[model samples]
Target chain A: MANMAEAVNVEALGAKQRRRFPHINWLALAMIMPSVIALLLIGLYPLLFAVSLSFQRFLLNRPQNNGMFVGFENYAAVLNDPLFWSSLGRTMTMLVIVLIVQIVAGIGIALLIDSSRWRVLNWTVKTALVIPIAMTPAVVGLLGVLIFNRDFGLMNYLLGLVGIEKINWLGDPTMAMVAIIITDIWQWTPFAALIMLSSLAIVPHEMVEAARLDTKSPWMIFRHVKLPYLMPGITAFMIIRTADVLKLFDMPFTLTRGGPGVSTELISLYVQRMGFRIFDMGVASAQAVLLLILCIVLARAYIHFFYRTPEAE
Target chain B: MAQAQNLQTNLLAQQARAIARRRSRIPASAWLQLVLLLLLLLFILTPFYWMVSTSLKEQNDTFAIPPKILFTPTLEHYNFVLFSPSAIVPTGLQNSLIVATFTTLLALLLGTPAAYILARFEFRGKRDLWFWFISNRFISPIVVALPFFLIARDLRMLNTPQALILIYLTFNIPLVVWLCLDQFRAIPRDLDEQAKVDGCNLFQSFWRINLPLAIPGVVVSAILCFIFSWNELLFALILNRSTGQTAPVQAANFMTGFGVKWGEMMATGTLIVLPVVLFAAIVSRHLARGLTMGAIK
Candidate 1:
């Protein structure tokens, strides 16, 4: 084994490798120096500084003399607060709901598209679904706002045609969360579908044919074959979307302002309200660190079950 | 001889069964396709139709006893929003454009080269560096807003275009670098090595050779960055005043007025939403790998 490793050893070529690839082009490094520096100072340092700020009171008015050590007190405070707990609870449940809807829609749509041998319907529906992806969450939220606007919104207009009473979408607490969820489905179902469709399109034809030969139903084929194959993409996307949906801000903020009495206040929105709106940096940073931990933990679990590790983790 | 005939009959029976099974499922398959097609149409068209229909309604007609789909459409709302004495509609559009242009230009200017180096060079902590940048996503925008609030305050950059440019970079740079990074990396290193040997300086090689190769990705990234910055409200709201608010923030503000300016806000919403949706649909449709500059996952 050692001898085999030595034979294929990459670093063994060392000096010879440098000579062969001999173009470090220090000038590229020279031009890159400022940008690299700027990224470090601007992009990187803020993250580190923010983490530290979590431990200290970096309040706006008290900027000069506010470096008192408060060890986990902020985390403790956030934990004890019902507002944080509830928002987090809401965010998680919402994540599960949105995720289930998106994934099912994604897998189902992909399956439909994949099975249809006809060129016309297959191409048209797939093309149309991709349109939702182009719409930003902000625009989607605005669209939702227009639709849900109680007095003169499009949704009310539609309901009027049906003889239904106008419902308060952004105003009522129950309706506010529903409004956000609908907006997300509008924008992101396409994303989930597009990614899943790519993976589904490549499932081995022979395996599917063999399954069919064995008298498997389409549902069974999906449950047994396509599902297992699509797991990795689904897992990776879930990791991304979970981290994202947890930070749901733009849409909710725009549509509801976390209002109708905090019904739609997600965690990131909660943190922003604490940090920026209230200028309570210590608590806000603490809130941020806790969120980071939650995200990392969730991500680790996702990586474990679904993502093949770089180190096979 | 009898056993061989039996085996041949069984094989033919299996083939027939397979064909029969397929034939039986054909109607069901067609029915399934029809149902899915209807769902797809409803899913895509409902909101779009609703948007145009709402935009067409009279301001008072919108809140009618029942919703009016067939009411006579009027240009009154559009006229009110666009030409109203009170609305800063033009300023909002201009602010969005200026901020978006500045942010996109700067991100491309700085990000493309850095993206190139990170993509090509095998540097130390490359992954960590990449994560360090993309991890900006992980940091809630609220966190960014807080520090920048101080930074902005300290420099008195509040409400200034430069502040938006700076704070916007907190998120936008990583986005640009990540997107451009993949494109830059896809270009073979041999191209750069050849440019170096041809007496091009590092900047010259990067600008003259590598850049042209990375143009498609850069333009796509520029579109994404512009759309994001244009639509960005958290920072735009914090850093700029009403006079300087980006289109989305401005539109959002219009909704906060007494009883909400439904018509005006929708008009502004339509303006901002249309371009971005089209751009994403047409330009940034590459289902390729993310534009990460080699470091971040």
Candidate 2:
């Protein structure tokens, strides 16, 4: 998108140079003004306000105190709180697990589809994969609840058929974490697959043939050839998936509600509970600012790596 | 020479097949792949199948162990979801439709002209202006939820679809701007110049010339905006606490209040998934492209 935009802008510049027809650049500004103003009011202003709120003591529970200048007190307090640290830790853990599983499973599916002999089979698999991608994450959470229902859920029933014991997928704290992870994997693996598949479609056949000519082992061929081609897609997947997982609210919110004593309390859910339910705006804002920083830093690093790596070329 | 060439070509063909065989490993790899693909499909689609099946099953059948793979399907849950006296589905659907439609329209209205300008004309700080508009997409909704709530409360727009529409514009406008910028850029500048030569001002030329060609982008953005609003939970959950709950929030409500109503929840889940899934299928490529922010081809 950026490439196309830049290309067009350059073309337009050339055209403008050729035919300087009374340029009204002000009209361009006028055209964009509404969006600019709306974004400032609704988007940028709220963010700045949130940052400002993070520095003040605006606790709803202690409404007797107004927005006093706490001056980093909320950050200090939040940093000291074990729950905040634990939730952040848990969120990081979830991010790693979900990202790793989704990318690996996604690449596997992509390779499987790429290697399919029949066109019909490939199309069917691709269509089936994307179905999960389109489903609402909240519904996916609810679906997790039903699927993990101990007595009647298909999970237990299928387990029974395989002579395994019934497990409390969501009731047990560890299993609850596992359940959310599973739900997230199910929901997003297809996204990874779709991206990898598209990228895989563009992997040069000549490179693959050359690799085949050089190596008899499939793993060697893949390592030397296909993996390099897939790196960009994988990196893009990682950046996007990691950023999203950090803000995971809907799935865990609906599935476990941070579950069985804060085990699944992701950062977003933790912040929401703090800000809304507990009405600790100061602490919540502090946590949110931290999350925003983390996301921005992570996205920036990945984007830099994505662009800087000559391997993508 | 012909015979020698034929022999060499045949030798290469056999060598190629041998390498292909080594890559494939087994002669029955196709069958093996088919079976595995079927299993993967089952893994992916069963949740949906279960969702739909549970929605259709009789209340008892939903819980039947060795779960009923086949049952006399019924619309009892659908009936309950749609027709129950306390049914929130109808209300939720209405709210979702209203909010999503207006949000899409508003985003398009506010985003299109900006996109056209970015596409056609050179300006100062154009890159910065474009970044400011589209970067809102990366801001987590949680970061803005409370401030927006406070803003809405101050403005007395809380618990209304309008609040959702306006707050949602934070991302929707960016999305529209980015998507439509690409679309507008794809149209040649010669057309605009020609239209100008024929006595159309910039706005007229844009309206009569550029806008019509960019309908597909507008439509795609509209669908995306609608889906985002429809599936949105956090803002709708927080902002519209009571009267204007969207379908996603309403579906979530079924899980918490009272004992869990499995059938009706599934019914609601099915309902929520159906429209978006249909929309995604109809424009699946566009949907994927949109998610990547048009970054990937």
Candidate 3:
């Protein structure tokens, strides 16, 4: 057994011994230098500095005492602040609702498209869906403003046709959230659907046919065959959407300005307002760090769930 | 055996008859699906229709209750947005084009080499390094806004297109690297080995063989980068405050200043949305594949 192990090691070492390309490592280093430097300066440095700022006093307006180390104070302040917790809650709420809606709607659309007999219509419908996905978020927000505008908005105009009273979308706090969700759903459901359709396209039809033969019910086939095939795509969509919703700023910024009183203030908007508007850099940085932790934790959980945890036999 | 043969023949006949029936008239299910598709299209297209139709309406017609679907379309809004000397639209469009174009070019330059190494080599700390690159995409741009602002201020790079370009590289590089990594992986490794056996160095093989093969991927990544850079708001909002504002930033500002100018805003939205939607359609398959992290195809 020892001789066999030694032989395996020898073979591994032999395979590791590629033909000498002198200075290749240096060349590779040279090649990667530009990106490495850029990421370091922009990605790594900002992250580190943000963490440092979290432990210090760096208010923009009060620059006299900027960068003074005040460890844990900022964290304490952010923790103690009710607004931070509330906005974080709103952020999570938005993420969950939007994700659930987009995913379900997306799957429905995908299944519809996948099973549809009209090939030309399928192509046309897909192209239409791509429009929302391709629109700039800011523009999407502007479009939302136009659609949901209280008096002359298309929504109200349509509601009037049904003899219903005009509803204030951006005015009421709860309605503002709804408006944001509506815009987000319109923009992102297509993304989820597109992803789902592509994955569904490649699902082996034989299994589906066999399952159909075994059971006449569509739900049974979907549960047994399609859902498993869709799990990875769904998970991917979930990750992307979760990360995006957590950082949603552009929509609320344009639509409501976190308005009527911070009702639609996502964490990104919260952090931006704190740092830029109020000039509370330290606490904003703390909130930013917490936001980061939240994102990483959520992402890690999804990844673990998707990849499956290691098990001992 | 004779009975089974008769059943099989009957089954084949039935299928042929069913095919003939389908050819003769559209199936009920097909009609149902077509209706469903049309409903979804209406839901999807209404907002866009509102944008374009509103853009073409006169200002009074834009706000007219039970909005004008049959009114004479006008280009007054577009004329104001484009031709006015003080119009931010033309300048914003120009800036957006410049910044997005350069960012795509620079990102490709920096990212292609990194993607190649990550794809071909089994180096130390590779997984960690690659993760580090990808995780940048997940980091909220808002989180970096303040720090970026401070750094830019300190460096006297504030309110310049270059500042915006440099800031974009952080996210764009990671994006290009990951997307290009998928592209490079799709390519066979044997080609590299063959090129090497022919006295080509590693760099030469990559430059001559892999880079050319990966052009489709590069084009897809470049388009994505362009769309992202064009659509970017928070960074551009912060980094380019006044003189260097991009189209999206200008559009957002239109909401804040005074009475909402729906017509002009819609025009701007239409302008920004048009190029990107076109780009997306051109590479829709690649975009979807990349969004799936190349897990689809």
User: Every model's DockQ, to 2 decimals?
Assistant: 0.27, 0.43, 0.45
**Candidate 3, B12-117: lDDT as tens digits:** 9999999998787877888788899999999999999999999998889988876888999888889989998778799999999999999999999999988988
Q: All candidates' lDDT scores?
A: 0.72, 0.83, 0.85
> Which residue runs of candidate 2 sit more than 4 Å off their true CA positions?
A1-24, A302-313, B1-26
Every model's Cα RMSD, please?
8.5, 7.2, 6.4
Best by lDDT: 3
lDDT of 3: 0.85
Fnat by candidate, in order: 0.38, 0.58, 0.62
- The stretch of ten residues in a row with the least summed lDDT in candidate 1 chain A is A304-313
Off by over 4 Å in 3: A1-24, A301-313, B1-20, B23-25, B295-297
Which model is ahead, 1 or 3, in terms of TM-score? 3
Which portion of correct inter-chain contacts appears in model 1? 0.38
Candidate 3 at residue A271, lDDT?
Answer: 94
Order the candidates by TM-score, highest first. 3, 2, 1
Give the better candidate number (1 or 2) by TM-score: 2
Instruction: Report the candidate with higher DockQ, 1 versus 3.
Output: 3
